[model samples]
Target: MQRNRSKRYRAAAQQVDRAKAYSLPEAVSTLKKFPPTKFDQTVTVSFRLGVDPKQSDQMVRGTCPLPHGSGKQVRVLVFAEGESAQAAREAGAEF
Candidate 1:
């Protein structure tokens, strides 16, 4: 049973590869046939900071890039004050 399943999976993968090579347009159109139901989906992501505090003057902060660009919009929040906040605003940050 396991061997049969493996054979079927390999055959399917090969068919996909052949389709990608021969009928690239059909393959892409078929993929785009399925429309996502939800447009705005919020996902939480985390990252680890491995910077040495003694060696580095500036500490690493904030969230990193998400896989597949999060498939959502991003809103940047800045808590800087005075000149720093003005600089951030000039740099095109929302807040």
Candidate 2:
């Protein structure tokens, strides 16, 4: 059982390493080639950013990277209503 677990972990780690070989820009470009679908509605990328500690909140900022660069040409459908809906629209969100 222990050996099986270790093998599973190693496989997962290898997959991550393969993904790391891809740059953010290249990944985003590849994703863009796909058409929008239910699954494609929300695609997130993860990466670390390099920043100066003194100038920023943290030297390394890590968050889900946008699969594509900002200013996505697709229209967004917001589910909020009333004030929240208005706020969403004000924030450049579409419905």
Candidate 3:
């Protein structure tokens, strides 16, 4: 389903030449020209994977740590058993 864009959005989009591929610096410069909005605009991306949902083997799930922190607080949990658990407690870990 296609939805029509607002006149403001269309007008802003028209100012740029679609055929031209912008370098990183050029793209950043172009974006800086846009008028500031009342609230910060959030950008998101979505991908459709070619996988059968019914097949367990086709399911995908995992975590990828960022080289730089993601600007969000994270909670880490480690399971320590037997001697390892005692060592962790002695190391001042919260129970």
**lDDT of each residue in 1-95, candidate 1, tens digit only:** 34545553455455454423435566556444443434554423243456776766756656978578977878778999999999998987896
- Candidate 2 per-residue lDDT, tens place, 1-95, comes to 34555554465445444635578787677556554444427566665555567875665555876667676677888999899999999998978
User: Candidate 3: how large is its RMSD?
Assistant: 7.4
Off by over 4 Å in 1: 1-22, 26-70
| Residue pairs clashing, model 1 | none
Backbone clashes, each candidate: 0, 1, 0
Query: How close is every model to the real structure, measured as TM-score?
Result: 0.31, 0.29, 0.45
What's model 1's lDDT at 15? 46
Question: By summed lDDT, which 10 consecutive residues of candidate 1 come out lowest?
Answer: 40-49
User: Across residues 1-95, which tens digit of lDDT does each residue of candidate 3 receive?
Assistant: 98999776777687678898667677778777766667878534335678887899998788998787788865445588999888877776666
Better of 2 and 3 by lDDT: 3
